[model samples]
Target: MTRSEQLFEEAAQYIPGGVNNPLRSFAGMGQPLRFIRRADESRVYDVDGHVYIDFVCSGGAALLGHNPPLVKKAVLEAVQNGLNYEACAEAELKLAKLIVQLVPSVQMVRMVSSVTEAVLSAVCAARSATGRKRLIRFAGCRHGGFDTAEGDPSGVSLLCGGGQDVLEAQYNDLSSVERLLEENKGQVAAVIIEPLAAHMGVIEPEPEFLQGLRRLCGQSGTILIFDETVTGFRLALGGAQEYYGVKPDMTIFGEILGAGLPAGALGGSRAIMEQLAPVGPVYQADACNGNPVAMAAGFAQLSSVLNQPLLYEKLAREGEALRAGLRELFPECTVGGVGSISSLLFTPGPVKHDRDAKRGDQGQFARYFSHMLQNGIFMMPSQFEPVFLSGAHTERDVEMFLEASAEFLA
Candidate 1:
């Protein structure tokens, strides 16, 4: 057996499912999970010494790619200074200021340790500010690990314990949102959505749909919250809000904003954000909130991103090349997404929402995944997740991916 297999066997004795995250188990692909030793640049090396081009890119957090020198230098420096102060620091202020300057709608920012905490705080603040109970979330839009809507029991009941009035609407369907608003009326506090639904295989938002959401939220006095955890810095320096020309009332960010570290933040107009404690009544706190190490890492990453004005352009060009290659090679499948994120669907064209994403042939995808892995390409095992490209991924890397994909198709 391989070293990775042996490690997995050892891990299974202690860790649940032999992995910390569900998707890591390779259950969706019906294959044994690879145990990674380390990752650098665009590649991850397994314990067995096998290397694969890592398309997952740490859930798109490593936009500059894994362990970029700038972020690494900042992290090491921060570690030498201290790990956590458990209090306000200059790093936090610097990161917050950068976020405020970059994101269009964020006026005041609150740091957190995870996207889940950020979402919870954002929703809580919205509820407090509006004096309302219900929150509206779209079906395909992921808001971290927590269950943001009723009837979605994917999250632990204990973590989702609260009897918060939550409502779910079909994604890209404005009429569904309007229907919910009509039903909930003044009781609706917020309408939260992933500006681009990466969790549902990179479903791009319909331009009219986002505009309609903004209009409806304004008309209904409900806060529109953009959960840009995956798309924030990766889509554009200003996030999906800037990319699409739609401004949300509040924005929750993670992934690239954290610079591959465990971090999240929620920001909005000061009038609504002040609802959080020490200013208003809504309460939220985390032991690792605004951790110095994470802040330093984020600042480094953000600074590098901002300094490179042509970064997004390169990503866009490469992503388009990859997408076009995939479509050209595999005419039977559908490809979707914008900028650096792309999803390969083993289904028909125009995959717009969760339901359409579900129609992809899972068995075919499982076989395709195995093939890609065999060819030294590491992709997300599930059909539901999108593949990510990073600044570190060269044009050659894209060609390699396309070549491997072509081989698999042949």
Candidate 2:
């Protein structure tokens, strides 16, 4: 048996399902999960002495790709100094300053531990700022740690609770959002959405949907929150708000902001963001918030990735080429996403929302996944997940992927 198999066997005895994250297990994906030794650039090396081009890119956090020189150096130096300070650090200030300079909507930002905390904090900030209780989230939008559901690969949760304060609406349907706003007029605190819906196979927003939402929020005095967990740095240096030309009152960021580390942030115009204590009443704190290592790493990565000339252009061009190739090769399958993020849905065309994404043939996808895994391609494994591209992924890597996919089709 392979060393990875042996490791999985040993781990199953202790670690639940032999994996830390549910997607790490091969339960539904139709093959044994390959154990990775290390990742570099655009490739991951498994314990079985195999190499696969890593398109997952740490859930799209490694836009600069895994362990880039600057990030590595920053992390190493920060580790040498110390781990956590539980207080302010220079690195935090640097990263926050850089983010504010880059993201126009986020005039002020607060550090947090994970995207889940960022979402919870953002919701709380919105409620506090507007003095309302209800939150409206879009179906199929992801909210990090709160993004949990079983079986249905095309998970379509609005990423909110069923309690009195939470309400849901369908994605890309501004009419639905309008209906909710009207029905709950003066009662809704915020309307949160994944500006790009990166969770459901990188579903781009429908034309004018965001503009309408912004207008409605402005009219209702409800805060508009954009869950930029996956889109923040990956989509564009300024994120989806800049990409789509719509500014949100608050932006929720994920680990991507920490350069693939366990850190996140919530931000908005200074007036709204100051609602969080010790500036205001809404409370949010964590021991690992603004961890020095993560902060240093994020500072280094973002300073480089967001400022590098034409890096985003390269990613966008390459992503389009790859998707175009997939479209030609897998004519029956649907290709979705924008900029550097792509998704191959084993379903029909125009996959806009969760309902459309759910039509994917998981059985066919399982067989396809098995074929791709055996042939040195490590995709996100689920139809709902986005296929992330990074600066490290060479043209040859894209060619190799398209060739392998063509072989599978043949």
Candidate 3:
């Protein structure tokens, strides 16, 4: 057996599913997961020393690519000083300031350990500020693991564990949201959604749909939140909210915001954000919310994006090339989404909602995923997830990927 196989065997004995995250497992691909030793730029080296061009980009966290020199230097400097003080740091303040400047609607920002915590804190803050108990979330738009945003099997509530009042609305369907607001009138605290629904195969909200949502929230006094955890720096430095020109009452961010470090943030107007504890009464705290190392890395990363705006332009051009290549190679498949985030649905026609995405051919996707992996291209094993492009991906990288994809499709 290979070293990776042996490692997986040993890992299975200790770690549940032999991996920390579900996507890391090879269940979807019907093969053993190849353990990666390290990643640099656009490539990852597996345990067997085979290298693959990574399209997953650490699940959209490696915007500037794996361990960019600047981020590494910042992290090293932070570590030399100290890893974590569990106390406030200047890096946190700097990152928060940068975020506020980039996202104008965010007057104040609160740091957290993960996107899940940020979402929970935002939900609590909305509840406290509005004095309401219900929430409305779009179907298949994952806001971390928060129960309030989890989709329900029954197609009614947000999730089974949460109360039935957490209604589920279909993406791009303004009427669904309007109906939910009408049904739960005066009791809905927030309307939370992934501005670009990455979890459900990258469903972008229609202009009218997003405008209607903002107007409905305004009319009903519901707190509108854009969960930009995946789309924050990856889509644009200012996030999908800025890209779509649809501002929300609050924004939740993670992943790329910390330059691959474990960090999250909640940002909104000061009046709404002040509801959190120590300022008001919502009550949310974290021991490592602003870890010094993570904060430093985040600041460095955000500074790079702010200073070098051309990086996004490069990413956009590369993403367009990659998307075009995929369309040419697989004309039978459905390709959707925008910017650096895109997905290939093994079905025909445009997929505008989760229900449409559910019709994708899982078996075909599994085959494609396996072929890509075997041919030195790494992507998420699940059809529901989207692929990410990085500034590090070159024209050569795009060509090699297309060649590999062509062979796989054949």
TM-score of each: 0.96, 0.96, 0.96
How do the residues 42-159 of candidate 2 rate in per-residue lDDT, one tens digit apiece? 9999988899999999988998999899999999999998899898899999999999998999899999988878888888888888888898877677676534344332222324
Per residue, candidate 3 scores C-alpha lDDT tens digits across 1-410 of 99988999999999998988765778868767899999999999998999999988978888888988899999999999987887888988988999999987799999999887888788889988998988888888887653333333222233222666567788889999999999998999999988888886877787678888999999999999999988887777778888888999999998677788899999999999999889989888888988888889988888887788688888888778888998998888777768788888888767889888899899998888888888898988887888888877888987888898899867
User: Model 2: runs farther than 4 Å from truth?
Assistant: 147-161
Q: lDDT tens digits, residues 12-55, model 1?
A: 99999888876676876766789888999999999888999999
Off by over 4 Å in 1: 147-164
Pick by lDDT: which candidate is best? 1
Local error of candidate 2 at 355, Å?
0.5
Q: RMSD (Cα, Å) of candidate 3? A: 2.2
The models' CA-based lDDT, in order, is 0.87, 0.86, 0.84
Clash totals, every prediction: 0, 0, 0
